[model samples]
Target: MLRYGLVVFIALLLSGCEMFGKKDIRLPIDVVSLQYDPYNYSMAELDRNATAACIAKGGTEAVAVDNEINTESVRWAYMNFNCYR
Candidate 1:
């Protein structure tokens, strides 16, 4: 039982660290809904980073579309942005 709990804890910890660096924004992704794990990040930060990425990809503007927070299963939040060229 104790071993199982420890394993679960480690798994969650590693998963949460998935966004440790700028891996999500390293590539030139499409100007669509950019889903991010808001576990240790702020919405403003996410938006700023995403917009910057868009601009770097030659987008004139990056407007946020929908911002929703899910409280049900697989709780998560999305930062949708429409990139205008």
Candidate 2:
């Protein structure tokens, strides 16, 4: 009896509930960390950090790289700054 019931269940599942064709099912997996590449577009903090670096080097903030810092460096810099504060 159990085997017959199991067979019916399997048949129904394979038949896509007798409605649509086989449905695509997505499964959730555990993620440890998700990191996305940072864009090169300049934001306020990028200006600040690079400016601070410039000032520490005895140069004006305007002399700082006028481009977006890579995302990984930005994250690391932000993480470091946050720890000190």
lDDT of 1 by residue, 1-85 (tens): 9999999999988887885743544332457566677565676877787778788878766777766666464546677787766
TM-score of each: 0.47, 0.28
Clashing pairs in 2: none
**Candidate 2 per-residue C-alpha lDDT over 1-85 given as tens digits, one digit per residue, 9 for 90 to 100:** 9999999999989787667865655332211111223553344655566456545544443222223346555543221111110
| Best candidate (score: TM-score) | 1
**Regions of model 1 farther than 4 Å from truth:** 1-30, 38-40
Q: How many residue pairs clash in each candidate?
A: 0, 0
Q: Alpha carbon lDDT of residue 51, candidate 2?
A: 50
**Reference-based lDDT, residue 21, model 2:** 60
